[model samples]
Every structure is written in C-alpha cells, then in structure tokens.
Target: MYSPTPSDWREANRKRWDERVPLHLASDYYDLEAFRSGKDPLRDFELAEVGDVTGRSLLHLQCHIGLDTLSWCRHGASRVVGLDFSEPAVDAARDLAAELGLTADQASFVAADVYDAADAVPDTSYDIVYTGVGALCWLPDIQRWAETVAALVAPGGFLYLAEFHPLADILDDETGSRIEYDYFARDAWIEETPGGYADTTTPTVHNRKVEWQHPVGEVITALASAGLRVDFLHEHDTTLFERFGSLELRDGAYQFPVDRPRIPLMYSLKASRAVA
Candidate 1:
C-alpha cells in the first residue's frame, strides 16, 4: 500500500503535479497548438451535459494550462477563472489568454495549492465550479476538496465533475491484458513497475504516485457532507483518455471490450448548494 496519509500525501502530490505541468503541456496529449486555434478539446458528452454558461461566473479547478477555461469564455461565459498549483502552467495559460486577445477580466489564472484555491480566489462568487478527467486520483482526501468547492460556489450554484471512476484504478494493466486492482479502497498506495502512461522510457523520479479510491457511493456521501446536494450521478462504460494501458480509441472515445463485464470507466456528478 502507498504511504503518507491525507496530510503529507497531498502536499507531495501537489509538488509532483507542479513539476509535471510543463511536461504535460509539451506532450501530445494536451495539444496546445490545436487548442489555440479555437478548437475545443472537450468531449461531446461533457459539452452536452454542461449546457450553456452564457454570462455565468465559472471557476475551473486544477485547470492545467487553462484550455477548458478559455473554452468556457469562447462559449459565452462572462467571467472564467482557472486555478492550479503549477506556476509554469498558470504562466503559460495567462500568456495564451492574452495572445488570444481575451481580456484580463474575462479570464484569469491563479497558481495555488488546490486545497487553498478558495482562499486565493473569490469565495461564494462562482455560478459553476467545474473539474474534469483524471483529477480526483491526485487528491488524497475528497472531503477537504469538497469543502473548498462548496466554499467557492455561491448559493444556487453547482459543482460539476466528470472523472474516471475509482473502480478503474485498481486493475492491473501490465500487458494491457486483464483487470487487477481491488474494487474497494484498501491500500493507500500500490507499488507499480516504473513507467507512466505518457512516457515509458524515462524512469520517474518518484516512481510511486500515491492515490486514494472513492467508490461512487463514497464520492456522493463526501460531497453531500460538504453541503452540496447530489443532483445526478451518471456512470459510463467508456472513457476520454486511454486507461488500462491497452485500450483502443474509437469514435473519438476510448473503449474496453463489450464481452467482459462492463465496468464503470467514468462518472459525472452535479451537486448544488442550498439557497440561503
């Protein structure tokens, strides 16, 4: 199992993510050039589910490089703010926004630890709080993260998240062959062979990345505990990114196999605060 409980684990993860921001931007996965040409990287599922944001105040958490944040402004959001712990990423995002002629007020970027994002940005000021794929695993504790989300969202506002389900995290994918990890949260960390999904040549400095698993039930319960009511929870059998190592991309989305027991690959949840 992974070491470091919620406390120090989060700090370490934040630092690691900060270091990875630059690498990710240059990687093919992000495709910054395509994003700059006004191309939207968001999937149709999210685009449809999130609906319109015209004139709404939106806050994007862990908005690595602000691609989606800019997309929000392009879609008619009056104000959009992006928060990330990575300084390099935030700088690039700010520069990119300016390069695109987006006014400073229309979109802004902040670099801060995720847990402290609410303190760095406006409190109770956002109409929508948005988070996306591969976000939750980096977080060690969902409860504290929920509190930060609740703090930033205004009354009647909602928090929207589309993330890879925790269940997918457990399986083994050594040969892109079979399911491996436990379905339930058991170990704090699982020691894996060296290699990241993006880069397989270089050995990771900290080969082990600590993670926590939160079942759909635990996720809903945690969010509700933070004073946000669960509006809907939808689980899909497909994912946006390549997961389980050998998954193939088809029809603009990644898929496993239909023959195997359909495991929940992704989930989206909307929660709202009680009007005061």
Candidate 2:
C-alpha cells in the first residue's frame, strides 16, 4: 500500500524532471542543435492528426524545455505558452526560446503544476491545448487533469494528446511478452530510476519518483466527463523511443519484431469543446 500526499509526489517528480533538463538539452534525443537550425520537434502523426495550427492560440501542458511548444510557433501558431512544474525546465525553455530569437510575444514558458494550470496561465481558453509524449504518467488524477484541460480549451477548440499506450506501460520493456505492471490505476508505481529516459549513462540526484497508469477507456471517459467530445482515437504500432530491447528502428520510429504479435505502442486522441 503506497500512499503519499499529492504535494509530496508532485515535488518528487518535479525534482526528477528538473534534474533531467540539462541532460535532455545535451542529449541527441532532443537534438537542441538541430532544433536551433529550424528542425521541427513535432512528429509526423501529431502533425497529421492535429492538423494545421496557423494563426491559432496554443497551450502546451507538461511541456518540458518547450521544444514542441516553440515548434508550434514555427508551425504558425499565433500565440504559444508552455507550462511545466519544474523551475529548471521552465528556465531552460525560456533560455532556448530566447537563444532561438523568439520574442516573448511569440512563445513563453511558465513554471506551474499542471493541476494548477488554470490559475497559472492568464488566458482561460486557448484555441488548441496540445500535450505530447511522456507527460500524462506523472499525473496522479486523470479526472482533475481532464478538468484543467477542459477549462483551458475554448468553445470550438480542441485538446490534442499523444502518449505512450497504457498497454505498453504494463508490458515488461525487457522481454515485451509478459505483463509486469497493473494496467489500471490502483496505486502509484513508485520507482528508483537513477537515470531517466533521455540519458541513462548519467545518474540523477532525484532518483525516486511516482507514476500512474490510465487505460484508454479511462482517458476517454475522463475527457467525456469533462464535457469534451471525442473526435477520434488513433493507435500506432510504432513508438518514439526504443522502449523494448528487441525493438528495431525504421523510418525514425521504433517498432516490435516482425514475427511477434503486433500491439499498439502509442495512441493519440483529439477531443473538442462544443460551440457555445
């Protein structure tokens, strides 16, 4: 029975993300150099699913270091704001935006917990609320998150979410055959991850953190309950990273073995608020 205050878990995860900022900045996974040279941080699936963002207000939640957030700016978003709980991550995001010659009016980063995002961000509703990979696991309550997301989206606007499939989370990354974790969110998945996903060679000071799992049904239900209408849900056999040791890289994506049973590695959903 693992139970901790929400503040405690949040602080722990925030520390972990804060420490990973520097490593991600220098890591090839993020490729800050290429991003500076006008490379788009967004993936092909999200671009196709979310469609064009030209001249629209976009808010990126759990946006660490703001690569995707700034990329939205390049994709023709009129206004962009990135929000994260980690101060270091927020600071680094601001620095990168500045270094890339992006004015504050174009893109900005704010330090705030996602649960408290409604209060942290100035505008109540944005044209688009975009959240990218590896962001939702850190959250403890999906219902509350959905509420915040709902509130952030304006009437006729949409919330775009792209995350690792919950099925993938349950499977053992080492073997990829047996289920190692619970599919549903019963308790916190506490772990002592010394090295993060970005750079495994370097050890982190904030090693202990908590994570939660939300199945596809739970995710959609939460959004629906929050008053958002589901437009569509898409699953992919490919993932952004080589989560499993046996995965093969092709066309810039990591996928399971050809002979093995295929399963969804990631999912993307688009939900929109009804017109007033």
Q: Number of clashes in model 1? A: 5
Q: Per model, how many backbone clashes are there?
A: 5, 0
What is candidate 1's TM-score against the reference? 0.89
Q: Please provide, for model 1 over 68-145, each residue's C-alpha lDDT reduced to its tens digit, 9 standing for 90 to 100.
A: 889989999899999987788899899889989988789999988788987787544699999988777777678899
TM-score to true structure, per model? 0.89, 0.96
Estimate the Cα RMSD of every predicted model relative to the unseen true structure: 2.5, 1.4
Q: For candidate 2, what is the lDDT?
A: 0.90
In order, the Cα lDDT scores of the candidates are 0.79, 0.90
Clashes by residue pair, model 1: 2-189, 170-181, 171-180, 171-181, 172-180
> Which regions of candidate 1 deviate over 4 angstroms?
4-8, 174-179, 190-195, 201-208
